[model samples]
Target: MKPEPSSALFAGPFALATLSTPDGPEFPALVTPDGQALDLRDVFGDERLTTLDVLDRWETALPRLRAVAADAGPARTAVTDLRVHAPVAPRQVFQSGANYRQHVIDLHVAHRAPGDERPEGERRAEAAEIMDRRAAEDLPYVFTGLPSAITGPYDDVVLPAWAEKPDWELELAVVIGKAAHRVPVEDAPQYIAGYTIANDLTDRATVFRRDMPQIGTDWLRSKNAPGFTPLGPWIVPSESITDPDDLRVRLELNGETMQDESTADMIFKVARMVSYASQTARLLPGDLVLTGSPAGNGMHWGRLLRDGDVMEGTITGLGVQRTRCVAEGAA
Candidate 1:
């Protein structure tokens, strides 16, 4: 029971997507600026051509895609009639943490010791100063994510019974087009194929290991649950975005605005994040690099997710994805 967004999903001449009819096999697709979607089989003339295959041949396929968008004609289908899936099935997922200046500052201020009563202004200032130093002198913190956790953008998010504090984290996802290993920051853009939206759900209750305090956060349990990451309706080509840093990242909970911020608040920008990740591991085509989420998560507001809550997320030009929260084992 999802509603259509107010505007076109993406304003680009064309974008990449994965779609299928009810009970039909998923296939790579080309989406027009007007919201018409055409299966890429027409372009590839091969049933085996998948979304990742298209990404693997992005350069050779770009011109063909543009031509198709200009003349979709009779082959076009309205996007509403199709079941959209996550655009690419990545072999590897690299996610950034505490990458937003305000998000970290807010979290630091909010989680102060119970008995220690520092003035709000003073606490925020101290956190802000620390963030500034980290931004200037520290490397971006990144971690791995499981591809099995990815679900379709509009899918249901089942809150596990054991998860006491489930939360939402809407972020911009970067799709790799070229294989990059130890790539320089200036050259990171060439390795990026496109951008998509991802909602990185977390179970805050499992974030810290109470039994082994020295071991610190338990990301595997806290962040990698099945269907924890809801990703994409489409992959908007990097060329379509004039300035990724200027885009707005927003999310609404049951029609109430929750997380709303600009990419400008990021401590580590897209290019830098990609370059940093590449220095440690090779980034292959279709792999995803998730920019950290912005401030205004459920933890910040002291109101976590509940069954039947609907989360609608949107990144400027990348489109919107609506996910309903369902308690585990609900019919």
Candidate 2:
């Protein structure tokens, strides 16, 4: 909690979060803008209702959630007093890679192999040209992520011993509201339930199959480790965000700002990414679509994550997410 003001926790009139008391089971909750968390078990009239269940019938649940948020009684508890968890347990995760215009160019130049002594300016110009062509002709580079990689916003991220170059990629996560199959980009918005934040942690050492160069990137090995994706403190309704393309996505490593870019830098916007994903597979309620991370990852700055590092990430209108890095076998 760090004594940060409640206003920094969420935006709009209200947001949805998963929370639990010290010894109680985790449950869905409606969090007011002022930080009061009202458990939705009684409101839903079912103790077994999870956030996924609420999202399954988002159209019907929205009105009820709004009504509760508007007049949450004294039965609510302060959010600071409860243990926060990931907003929802997603069944599927679609992650977009190299989708940021500037981020890709930066990665291209920074990751030059040994003995490649081309000037930085020339390398950057070449990278920019490649990015421009990709935007014009190639579809977004989207990959599937395991839901097991997800962890709470405030949870500890255990950096495995094998991950020698762990890095951070803060992104805007699109939470699906309805089932979508082969949907058009124009109709993608209707399937969106809301938005949240996700930090897609990667291990640079495992990024490529060094033994098999033709295999290229290995996302599953580099990014799907447990606690690799630190998710939301809450999910802000899509209506609350005036423009998903205009939000600011920022991340700080141990109190130092590292990634501070805008969604405008994304090569393929949220709607297009979602629509593209639907073309290949059916998107169900509670599925997460992670828009690519903007520039300024640890590799770009030569400052990979280590034990005891703290990452604080926030997206405009979505809430703040803070996670502490812990060594795998730490006490």
Candidate 3:
């Protein structure tokens, strides 16, 4: 476990990362503000250190790691030399859908028929009314995501040959530190380990089942593609981030800002989403719960990912993640 104190400045703040050393397999590392990587084992003096170990012991581990970060100097290895892995390997991943107010409204407007003479303002007002009703009702839309879809922050987003409209939906992902089931919204934050960024890549063309319209969204076929969820470069402990809702979420496609909104736009913010998810299932340590994507998807822009497109996503304190699109079969 070696701490690199000489790496270049990272795009933003981060606490922990899973990285592969030049000669070793992937391992958990503490990322310092100095942009250096500190092997958790070396810092904690434990050889069996892993990201999960730190998360499960977050009550005691985070503070110690922060103290080390406060004094970390130049990185030991060039930041570019390290290979970043998804900061976590969660046993279960829960995702919220259409959670952002404006995002869903945009989809509503975009999907309206061309011949419809309804005013845009009228449609938006109606959608807003529906969201208000939903908020009052306290129901959050959630779905399951397979860990097999997770990938490193810098990995390529493969556009499958069969997927014609592969699009990006960047989101704020919450990491659970404690087992929670039927927890109230007020008590939800206590179980949060930290936050990371997730680009919830979707296959727009397959969102609805062609053969079974009544069956609705076929998320498995449209979303669970290999390397679809380009996760964290690192995880920022929950305590470090003052307010998850106030953070900014922005994604640039080919250097153009597409999705730019705050988590505050979420109809059911982090706590409610967590609490809602807990109502049905137990959330364990290291579980990844996506808070939902906020507007600005390619579907609204009339464009979709192609083999050479590049996407860069950032969520406030979380660091940036760049993923280039590639044809599934291309080398």
Candidate 4:
């Protein structure tokens, strides 16, 4: 079971959401200023007011939504009264790879390939040097993930039978609000919609193809599995978070703290990641750019996911995600 958060919700600006219900269809709602929620249809007097509707007009809708939230007092529904679903259905997902200092360093020292015969200290130093050079010379490493892999924050993660080692990667996901192609770092923030938390679950056993080493990594087979990415409970506006580079990302597995690190550890920051992503592909509204996962993955802890295990991931103000793991049946 996931424990309740210690902090309050009204301290900042959060966006709308689509809710899950038992009796009727899913509905869109606003996260009011008072931490309560209001039906978007009622607030806007338009039944077609979906979270996507709000996102499509994010720049103009923000002021109006903020006003509604501010004025929404006693009449608002308690957030606890409704079950929250994924805030928005993203059109695309871009994941960063080997972008964390500690994470990559850990991998280098752990995997004793032909060249990894160096001492642990030497390996750490080498990895640090490599990151420094990459930041100065190389562009960010990114790859596409199927949007269909996304699921609700508190949903169950059904582990496929073919996956022998499923790992958890808690990352800060940036949601784009506008289109950008080949954008500069200075102008990247203008394209951002907000921030959300995403758990980029991966099948470690299939990351690299054993049969065909020359073809490189098989990210599609290792990643992109259904319900592999668990997204937010809410999306905090870009303005709400003062510094994207200075947030804490944490994940606890089955009541034990596993991955806990600062966003400060990212090799490439948000602006650079967004800018680099737009260099080739056109980044449209509602697309997700997942900043790479920080240190302390399952590989570092020597334990991968299993049935009935609970993963609770929190990224500063973005929100918490509690995903219960279950094994897939042969049926």
Candidate number with the higher TM-score (1 or 3): 1
Model 3 segments beyond 4 Å from truth? 1-14, 71-78, 112-125
Which wins on lDDT, candidate 2 or candidate 4?
A: 2
TM-score of 4: 0.93
How do the predictions measure up, each by TM-score? 0.96, 0.97, 0.91, 0.93
lDDT score for residue 85 of model 4 = 80
Q: Please, what are the lDDT tens digits per residue for candidate 3 over residues 188-240?
A: 99999889999999998888877877898899999999999999877888877
Over 12-94, each residue of candidate 2 has an lDDT whose tens digit, in order, gives 88888899888999999988878888888888889998999999999999998888877736388888888899999999999
Worst lDDT run of 10 residues, candidate 4, spans 1-10
Provide the lowest-lDDT 10-residue window in model 3. 1-10
In model 1, what is the error at residue 262, expressed in angstroms? 0.5
Better of 1 and 3 by lDDT: 1
- Decide which is better by TM-score, 3 or 4: 4
lDDT of 1 by residue, 1-331 (tens): 3327445778588889999888899999998766778989877898978999998988888888888888847478887888888889999999999899988887778667557698989999998998899888958999999999999988999899989999999999999998999999999999999999999999988888878878988999999989899999889999999989889999999999999999999999999999999999999999999999999999789899999999999999998898999999898
Worst window of 10 by summed lDDT in candidate 1:
1-10
Look at candidate 1 and tell me the lDDT of residue 187: 96
Residue 83's lDDT within candidate 2 is 89
lDDT of every predicted structure (CA atoms) = 0.90, 0.91, 0.86, 0.83
Ranking by TM-score: 2, 1, 4, 3
